[model samples]
Every structure is written in C-alpha cells, then in structure tokens.
Target: RFGMLETVSEFAGEQLAAHGELEMVRGQHARYFLALGEAAAPHLRVAGQTAWMDRLEAEHPNLRAALAWLLAAREGEEAVRLAGALWWFWYIRGYPSEGQQWLSRTLASGGSSIARAAALVGAGWFALDQGDVTPGLAALEEAVALQRAAGDRQGIATALNWLGNAYVHERQYARAEQIHTEVLALRRQLDDQPGIAASLANLAGC
Candidate 1:
C-alpha cells in the first residue's frame, strides 16, 4: 500500500517520459493490476469474499489509475479485461454507475470478442440495475451471441443468467422462465453446483 508524494510521483513520471520509458512502465503497471484484479475475481465470489473485497478496496486507486492509463493509451482489449474483472467489485461497493460508464467507454473502444462479451455482461448488469432496460437487454443479448460464437459455454450460461434476471425485471415472466430453464440445463451440464442453485432460484422467482 505504499505510495509516493504527489510531487515526487509527478517528477518520477516526468523522468520516465524523458527517458522514453513512461509508456512501457505504464503498460507494466496496468498489466500487473489487471492480473491482481483477475486473481481476486474468483475469490470475491466464494470463500474469503470479504478479505478479497478488502484487498481490492485497498487497491482501488491503483486499479483506477491502471484503467485510466489503458483507456488513454487506446488499449481496448486490456481495458475491457481490467474493467470486466473489477465489475463485481464496483457492484458490491455501490459504484454501479461508475462501473457502467467504464464498461461503456471500454466497449466503445472495441476489443476481442471474448473480452468484449465479458465486459458486455458487466455493462448489461449495471445498466439493468440502473433501470435502463433497452440497452441492458441489448448488451446481454449481444454478449450471449458473442460467447456462443466463441464456444464459451460458461460465459453463455453467465450471460443467460443475467438476461433471465433482466426479463424478470421487465415482468416478462414467461421469457424469464424459459431463460432460467436453459440456464439450469447448462449449469447441470457443466456440473456447476453454485450455478445450478442460482438457476433454480431464478426459475422459482420467475
């Protein structure tokens, strides 16, 4: 959690740029935080969730800096990856609006299909949370199509689960039920017990 004084940090940054190393250094920094975010992502969903959340919270500033650099550099794919990894953190930390903005900007910048699909899932959920149904539904639908084309079964199931929730939000119970049923089947096929439980719960709600 160490950090330099603002003046010192600025001076060092200037020196790096003077030496033609700023871009390289920034890239490394962004990649490091991206790895950190991805590593913490799984932990945030399961055991020791609070601990991982705290860890991310402590690194939040650095994570933002990394994302900002990535976006400024036009590293669309890397930016998407970083934002996607941090989406859950933003959601749980009550920063859905900010998360949505970052996701939207990164998506607009373009990325690989898989990366973009993952970011779309996050963006869609944020949009839905904010009651923007049309764009949210569109994002999730596109995510599903992209994930399906990429043969990412897990991604498809995840996106579908969110889509089902969106349908429920819109009071389209029949469509929600259909989507949840498909999610249940997919979870069973993947032997994802947690996902299976979620799908069942969603179906029950529908």
Candidate 2:
C-alpha cells in the first residue's frame, strides 16, 4: 500500500507540472485563459497561481496587454478583444469609459469601416443597457450599414439580431419579425446550423 501510494503521488506530481491548467496564451486565447484562471484560482495555491500568471505574461504579451486593460478598466483594441472574447465578458465587465475615448480616436483617425462598425455596435449595446433607445438604434443602424458596405455578412447578421431585439423591446413586432426572418434566411444560406438554432430561439422568444 505504501509503495502504491508513493507511485500515485509521483504520477500526480508529474501531472501537475505537465498540465497546470494555466498554459501560456495569447491573442484570442487570452480571454479563455483569464476565464480559466478566474475559475481555477480558488483551487490553486496563491503563490503558484501568481507564478503562473507571471510566466503567462512573460510568454504572451498580447494576453498580458488584454488582461491589463481589463484590470485597469481601460479600453482600446486590446481591451475590446478582452470584452469581445465572449458576450458574457462584456456583460460581466461592462464597457469602460476608455472605450469611448478610443472610439473617438479611431473615428477621427479614419479607421476602417470594420473598426468603426464594431465601435458603433459596442456603443449601441452600451446605450441599450442604459435605456437610451434612440442612440442605441442609431448606432446599431450605422453598424449594420457599415457591415453591409464592408461585405461582412456575418457581422451584418449579428447587428440585425440586435436591431431585431431592439425592435421587439419597442413593441414593434412586425419590424422585429422582418429582421428576424431576414437573419434566419441568411443563416440558412450560410449553412450555419448553430446560427439557425440561435436565430430560431431568438424569434421564438420574441
């Protein structure tokens, strides 16, 4: 029994070293890694976790930059990526005021339509959350138009889904239905089964 316990302990030690559940990460992996960090921190030793984060930062500057933005409540491409890592991140963290600063900067500097469209969408969502329908609708409208102009069908569809939700909130069922139907058609055309399911669920909820 003692020998078997020693063997098991040795194996567990190897597993911990080989797979920390805190691998070095960057780019899109940043958000997921941070999420895992948050989820697993409670179960990990504090000193070990700090060492892991330090190692992660050293290996992945982009991820570090993203995490710094979140920690500081700052906003820019780096911060936006962190927020957009998942919709839940945005909901949980909320848009930083610094985001508006960057948005204005991007617009003034003549950034690409895609960038502008994304900023506008972010603004629209922020406004919606604040109960300002006019600004929200206007921002989303611009985002949808820009997305179409940029030939970003997926982005356009996403904007359409939000716009449809806005319409439903305003009790404009007919308009919402039109937008939702259009989204469904586009999802089908794209052969996106998951998207179709989401759109269907959205429509059913409305």
Among all windows of 10 consecutive residues in model 2, the one with the lowest summed lDDT is 82-91
lDDT tens digits, residues 1-206, model 2?
A: 01237688577657766786323322335555546444542323333555544443343444444555444433344344333332222333343454444444434444456656766766676667768889889988998998899887888887788888888887888888899999999888888787799889878867
TM-score of each: 0.94, 0.56
**Model 2 spans with C-alpha error above 4 angstroms:** 1-88, 95-109
Q: Give the clashing residue pairs of candidate 1, or none.
A: none
lDDT of 1 by residue, 1-206 (tens): 53689999999999999999999998898899999998988787787899999999999899998999999999999999889888999999988888888998888887899989879989988988888889999999999999899988898898898889889989999999999999999999999999998888899999
lDDT of 1: 0.90
Weakest 10 consecutive residues of candidate 1 by summed lDDT:
38-47
Computed on alpha carbons, the lDDT of every model, listed in order, comes to: 0.90, 0.61
